[model samples]
Target: MRIAATLRMALRALRRNKMRSMLTALGIIIGVGAVIAMVGIGNGAKSQVEAQIASLGQNVVLVFAGNWSSGGVRSGWGGAGTMTVDDALAISREVPGVINVSPEVRDRQQIQANGLNWNTQILGEGPDYLDIREWPLQDGAMFTDQDVRGTTKVCIVGKTIVTQLFPNEGPVGKSLRIRDIPFKVLGVLSPKGLSVMGSDQDDVVIIPYTSEMKRVSKRTNLSSISVQSSSPEFSDIVQRGISDLLRQRHRLGANRDDDFTIRGQQEIADAATATTRIMTVLLGAIASVSLIVGGIGIMNIMLVSVTERTREIGIRMAVGAHGRDILLQFLIEAITLSSLGGVIGIVLGVGSAKLLSAIAGWPTLVSVTSVVLAFLFSAAVGVFFGFYPARKASNLDPIDALRYE
Candidate 1:
């Protein structure tokens, strides 16, 4: 009954100053709203980074040919003939963690199909290219090893190429002309949105490396080789093994510079994750300042409330109200004010996040965890800031409080 009476007194006091109560809660409202929105945006950015990393493929590493240097003139990496199909083959066989490897060369050509001409990237790759990149055909099957060994005039097309070259029908078994030479499309590659470099992933044609070397570019060395480890944890070990094998194969002494370069995609993923983590921390820190400011607002308004209700506090004490009763009353009032704000803030924050995504095309992920934290934080702010004011009211001398005008 005492607790019920205390609650009734709190509600009555709040009702007497409705406008002041709302204004006091406004600070908490803004703080909770800012926290939720900022965290949502941060989570969305992190998810985007993860998605882009996933697009690179699974447990992948890239090896490029050595840089060329000739008496005061030097060309950059992938500019030499140091990398070859034999190097890729050796790495796949010798490296303990290696699961797949494929050599590739690149060219550009006007590919004609269905009586239309479209200039696109031409990739010359071994049969293992599909396996190395974990790429599957959307329609037909991957080219056979025989197709690569025999340098057959068959190719696999990407989705963008399919859309451009064979819009009305399926790309399988269709003939695409590269450099005016006809080649049969064995399959269409499953769609991969974009490369890490922001280039269209599904805008190319892949043919046997032997075919490109023999019939097109006439290159004996590879432009690059792809290596895939059995697991992500084993990628570094596989990379080291490849480096050691290449060093031995290329006959480079310990004193000489490496004749090739090896890059792991894990490094890229780590960098992206680090960047998103920093952004999340920065945004959360900025929003936290509002919470502190709202706490101060609650304290200030509560102090003013204590001053205004001084005489009433004295009357209640004279009528046998205990100091704890008086303290509980003010504390409940403060908690009520902030709790109301927290509830409204949740609604506004979630709505704002959705609105931002819809109108600005920016991603925002509102999670239940963030919302619950915001609410709890608001309630905590009320207790912490309201305590001092409530204590002061409870301690006031009845004689002095009643003497005040």
Candidate 2:
């Protein structure tokens, strides 16, 4: 009951100076709101990066055929087809951590269906290519191993091809002609949006590598190979295993450089995530500075409040009130101010996050963890800043206080 009375008196004091109370809490409100909004944006960016990574493939590693060299004059990477179909098979069969290996030969060729012609990337892909790339079918079935061995004139296409050629119908079981040679469309791949390189991922046609060698590229070697591990944790092991195996297969001496290049998706993800994490921490740190400023504002206002209430303190002490009661009353007032600001800030922050997403086309995720931390910090600010003034009010010389103006 005594505590309740103290709270009532504290609230009444705030009510008597509504404008002053609100002004005092403005800094806290802004601080909490800014912190929440910034963190939301940071998380959103991180999520976008993760989604892009998943879209590319999970636990994927790419190996490009070596650069061409003549008399120590070397061309850029992927300039020569040094990696072969046998190399991909060896990695898949002999490597410990490798789960899937999809060898590929690439060409940019014109495709025609019903005389609707479109130029797209033509890939000579292994049977496990779809599995390795995590490219699902929107319709029909993937070409089989039997198709690859037979060098069947069969193909799978992506959404961009479908949109370009089969506008009103499905491309499955249809004929898409490449290089004046007709091939049956085995499937339509799911929409994959854009690749990390900003190219449309769905703008492609896939055929068996044997068929590509026989009919399209007339090349005996693979252009590249993508390897996938069972899990991300094993990617490094798989990469190392691949490197050692390839070096041996190519019969490279210790002094000679590797002909092929291997790149891991996990490496890309780690770099991107690390950059974003640093930015998030930096932004959140900047936002936290406002919270410190808010604490200072609270301290300043509380000191003024103590000075204004000195006469009241004197009267309460004269009327049998204990020092603890005076301290509790002031402390309760500061806490109420900060906590109320926090609540209002939460609403403001969430609203701002949604608005940013809608207006700016930037992703924003307002996590519960961020919200909880903000609220707790506000409470701490209240307690830390409110303590000194409340203590001074409690320890006042009541007779001197009563005699003052």
Q: Which candidate achieves the best lDDT against the true structure? A: 2
Model 2, residue 179: distance off in Å is: 2.7
lDDT of 1 at 126: 82
Per-residue error (Å), model 1, residue 400: 2.6
Summarize candidate 2's per-residue lDDT along 1-405 as a digit string, tens digits. Answer: 287887788789989999988988888898898889998899888888778778868889999888878898888877766788899999999999888888889989988998799999999988888888888998999988899899999999989998999999877888989998999998899999976556898999999999998899898888889899999899889999999999999999999888898889977777767867787888889988998898888889989999987898899889877888888988988888888788888788888989999999999999999999999999889998899999999999889878768
Model 1, residue 208: displacement in angstroms? Answer: 1.9
Give each model's whole-structure lDDT.
0.87, 0.88
Candidate 2 residue 42 C-alpha distance from true site, Å:
2.1
What total of clashing residue pairs does each candidate reach? 0, 0
- Candidate 2 Cα errors over 4 Å, as ranges: 1-9, 66-74, 316-328, 391-395
Instruction: Report the C-alpha displacement of residue 376, candidate 1, in angstroms.
Output: 3.0
> lDDT of candidate 1 vs native?
0.87
Over 125-203, each residue of candidate 1 has an lDDT whose tens digit, in order, gives 8887887777888989888789988999999999999899899999898898998789999999999887755789899
- TM-score computed on alpha carbons, candidate 2: 0.89
